[model samples]
Target chain A: MNYPNGQKKIISKQATSWQSKKSFSNRGMSLEDDINTTNQFYLDIDRAVIHKKPTPVQIVNVHYPRRSAAVITEAYFKQASTTDYNGLYRGKYVDFEAKETKNKTIFPLANIHEHQINHMKSIVEHEGICFLLIRFAAHEETYYMQAEKLFPYWYDKLHGGRKSIPYEKIKLDGFHIPLQYQARVDYLSVIDKLYF
Target chain B: MNYPNGQKKIISKQATSWQSKKSFSNRGMSLEDDINTTNQFYLDIDRAVIHKKPTPVQIVNVHYPRRSAAVITEAYFKQASTTDYNGLYRGKYVDFEAKETKNKTIFPLANIHEHQINHMKSIVEHEGICFLLIRFAAHEETYYMQAEKLFPYWYDKLHGGRKSIPYEKIKLDGFHIPLQYQARVDYLSVIDKLYF
Candidate 1:
């Protein structure tokens, strides 16, 4: 797979920094991978049950080879209706989207979809615990910000506000998630402090 | 779509009666579809926010044809790691599996997967609301039975007990969900009565 020139440069720089953090060498792994590993860790220890929703697909056709499993021959990816990760966490429905940005000053709102913002709003309205696990990759920092806190910036764009959230503001509003050996992105600890 | 002779006969009879229940005309629709529609009704009114997890698929290959959307050329169905439907209902986590049985006298244990039972067990362990929305298609009845109640029956089969739960026993232990105009399988009312 090939990334655009600018993104490719960022990837190379990320790979370089990944080497320095040799203990956590897997830092080069995508934020999604880290969270998946963390969720698996949670499940293993019976802390919380969470999972990433499968990529939605619109299957147009399938072929059942004589004795093998049916193969999807014609299909297209479908737009997801909700955020990827969601499950039960201490009796509360936990819903969130994980995203990362390379920008030093801001996290572009463009990385998030309007429907996803709306979905997060609905989850909040239903009294679920919703948030965004955003990683400022350049700073090697991940923060857990509640969905309610994000709505202002999302709606601000409609009211002629900045298109991206200033990293300084996020640092003030979001809780820094600590990284650990087994629990890669230990966001649940932040959840315990914030909600529980 | 083809079923064995005896099962096919049951399906034909089902199709015939499905047309007569014109009010619940969507009787031909799968149990999953009915619950999805019911969940939509709840969402539309801001009563709850729930969604069905997309069918999991293993994408082996994709073709990026020019500027058009990428076409999935090779993929196969994957077993889901969690329940079909889950979300927040009045500040609590609600998770459940929907399954239909053609048998008139009993609901077979084969309809429930071992992993799903374990998943439900974990949800209950975390104090979340978990249950099975079982539909007896032959009798045209649906029941909402809590997962904790199901554990004994599930374990009973593993310990050389009955392979199926009799319909009479279910009627005794499970709450019957009545069908309504817009909310076809209004299981939330049962949840309210039982959980709230």
Candidate 2:
């Protein structure tokens, strides 16, 4: 999925420079930034209606002042009970969780919570198209692994087997998602190839 | 769809009394409480996978203590871009917004925002089962109206027609969601009647 050498170099160099310099104040954002940009492009063109669900927060306290908005004063992040992104595509239900890991060898199992795994299982049971978008940041590669494929690993972990999935195993089993200019992660292309 | 006379009377009396007594601290909840309870029952029995999206929030500032969970110090409620709830059911994507109105004669269009109407239009265009759940609190009734049926009114409002939909019109055009002891707002029966 490479473009011309000069073009790829220029684009990535600018992204790396900006992300490294401008985002220390907002650390750990650029990983999902590509997907967000991609989803927005999809929405703008009316290709799909996917959206990243809002981060779940537990509001414990609020302050209301006259002639102003109510401000949340105390809150905490709650564990999400479902996948991060889901929407309709081609008249089918599409659901997925996107995650990025820096580890070069294996994707640690702990990156996904138990409840999210259960939710994915329920989606599959109901015949919805469910999958995971995993990015290896160091390798600059994304893979689309269907939820059905992830269950064996989840069961292994439950039965006290390997705690992480090897990079090689994912490379063999998962489809490599080509990064497109407009749809950055471009997982929908993989979904098209697999299903349609 | 009335249950045994005594059963319905007891449940209504208990709910009205409890809601009046205990829910002033959490205003505007019981209307959705029925739906939420219904959804939970659906989940427990593996009937459908539906969820009310967590309220969208924009977090501006947070304070992280060395030994405690991060506390959000400043945040604001953000206008939701899509409907309030969505999930897969019987291999179909179901998306809907739930609104409760105290008005007995009319369901105000002002309860829904312009952007949300645009989003619902997109959902219907993509062939998802998109609808609205309107609860007339004063009348103790909930009605399900399809998104396609709503476009005319939405456009009429845009062109300086009636600003609100009358209760009588909703009663005629929409399907009255029967209240079951288990599936309190039983809209799925209407869905089966309409689509399947």
Candidate 3:
């Protein structure tokens, strides 16, 4: 396959075959759910250990529903200081953020926060595997773009370039994550190829 | 000073004098407030960057109060899979659970869940620093007890022993966290002495 920018796309035939067999029928699985299922599979198989960080919530008002249960009556989402997924993999810390975009031609840099980029930089400096898992829903493709490729483009965007990472650039620079039967978002396969 | 068990208490006279002069005020502070202040101090001073995991809430109902804000009308506290605080310290992963006890003579083991203990064990197996910050609220004394010491006692409790860890045992096995001007918990000081 080729993009508009004339970049050759390395589409995995095996991944396409797996996607065809899978229906993802659990209340319409979101990207988060798929990643979580993948992480669980990794844990069960004793592969790379990974987990999604619990959603940060600030409790303002809580009511005692029963002796054992406390019902939160008021709360708000709090900004997370670190990326969603971070854990040790083969004696090295692996950290990454997962985001999905509906845009066919571009992946919006705005989907990622400044702090997340900084966090990824620190992880990279500390000799950890750091990257972003970008999913283009329109194309039904997921790419694992390393922090080195992301930071320069992110800075360029800050200096008034395009606000999105071109699909062609992602296709060229990123590793496509294979969707699996057990590990729904099987990102570790990409990590194993790229890092190890 | 000597306990009924005939163990000589290691009371630092200098520390006592320092505490008297400082007048450590536990009256005005809630457990949450003290922890937040301590975390801020940790971050500012570059001492063991630790943060409390945010309270997990499952939002079920929401009301649009205004165009700008959505108010959560109903939610419930989700069961936490891991302990409260975790972070990196001096290239070592640090994970711990903090609890406060009103009892003067005993710290209840029942306060800790089995899953939390298991999580701490896994952290220890991975060469991470895993411990518990236990505060005896009645005496205004806080101690950092290593998970290794905690496990045996927890098992003994399961076999019908006293449900609480005796204050004397805590004093012997755990490091007494000194109250400091900048860092309220001053746990890293104890960690340095015990681990590093």
Candidate 4:
């Protein structure tokens, strides 16, 4: 498919059915959708109260038709100053951002934002559960890197280091999140091992 | 002015600069906007962290332009299961819903959803700061009613009684939130009186 401005769209041969079925086994669906489903499952089972924060959108213009509902005619996404997910679990606040990439060698630090890093740092200082869920999509691997481990490297990146976190370094510092039938992400298992 | 429905359109007058400058003595802005501005001010001052939860919308269709941004062609408002705002304040969880009505006689319980009532109950049970900011727009009066005070009445609504909370009852039960320049709503002052 060709987009405007002469940009070519590369279509992958990934089957929709296979992706839906193996969603728990690999980084199948978009990270956001998978995490939302996982959070709902957790809520259903009374395991935790985690939730995906809704995308902040600024609605500039709204049209209210007499017979129909209100229509958001114009809106734009606002820059989020916090992590994607947060909730209370076992009397502790859990805060995290989940990201997935197709790259096999490294996870780019550019995927994380400075404001998000600062938010995580504040959460850590306040004795909250803070971490990042990084998924290596090509290898179907997911790792939970604690905020303390990522803080030093993030500061180093500011001082002219590589813009990507190497897979080997992630493997050395992060804990592998278990894949489960119910809690697909099962990040709490990693949290249990590291914090609890 | 007139609308398509053959009804005269009464334009809401915008406050002039001089009028706005004297707003601290008057009713000032809408309760929703005041709370939002107060939250932003709190964020800036490194005070209690709080935010208004985004309105949930279910997208039915989307028009993805080749070059331009994606347009939401069709969508519907989803009933929110929780309150409008929630976040941490002084290491404590704070959750609340803000509602406004021009009615002078009473505040209808119908405005409060059953799911939201249940959610507030759970939050209170978990020892969180939970309340409702009720605005009697006709009187230009705002009150902060604790969730505990409202729950019994909410549960009683299903039994047999008026399906609304009368203004006289609220005057007796709710705390009158003071209007302020910076913290417009200044609900924490009520919190200080009630909880602290």
Pairs that collide, model 1: none
Per residue, candidate 1 scores C-alpha lDDT tens digits across B23-101 of 2324576677678789899989988988888878667677766756666776676667788889899999999998888
lDDT of 1 at A15: 26
Per-residue lDDT for B95 in model 3? 73
Per-prediction DockQ scores?
0.30, 0.29, 0.15, 0.15
State the lDDT of candidate 4 residue by residue for B78-154, as single tens digits.
56767888766656667899888778989999999897897787677656788999988878788999999998888
Q: What is the C-alpha RMSD of each candidate to the true structure, in Å?
A: 9.4, 10.1, 14.0, 9.1
What are the clashing pairs of model 4? none
Instruction: Assess every candidate by TM-score.
Output: 0.86, 0.86, 0.78, 0.79
- Fnat of candidate 2: 0.53
Which ranges of candidate 2 are over 4 A from the true structure? A1-29, B1-29
DockQ of 3: 0.15
For candidate 2, what is the lDDT?
0.80
Best by DockQ: 1
- lDDT string, candidate 2, B1-196, tens digits: 1211112223233323422332421334465687888888889999889998877866667776676666677666667889989998999999999887878999889989898899999899899999999988777788999988888888999999998899999999899986678888877788889889
Candidate 3 TM-score to native:
0.78
Candidate 4 chain B minimal-lDDT segment of 10 residues: B11-20
Fraction of the reference Cα-Cα interface contacts (below 8 Å) that each candidate reproduces: 0.59, 0.53, 0.22, 0.06
> Could you tell me how far off, in angstroms, the CA of residue A190 lies in candidate 4 after the best superposition?
4.0
The residue pairs found clashing in candidate 2 are none
In order, candidate lDDTs are 0.81, 0.80, 0.70, 0.72
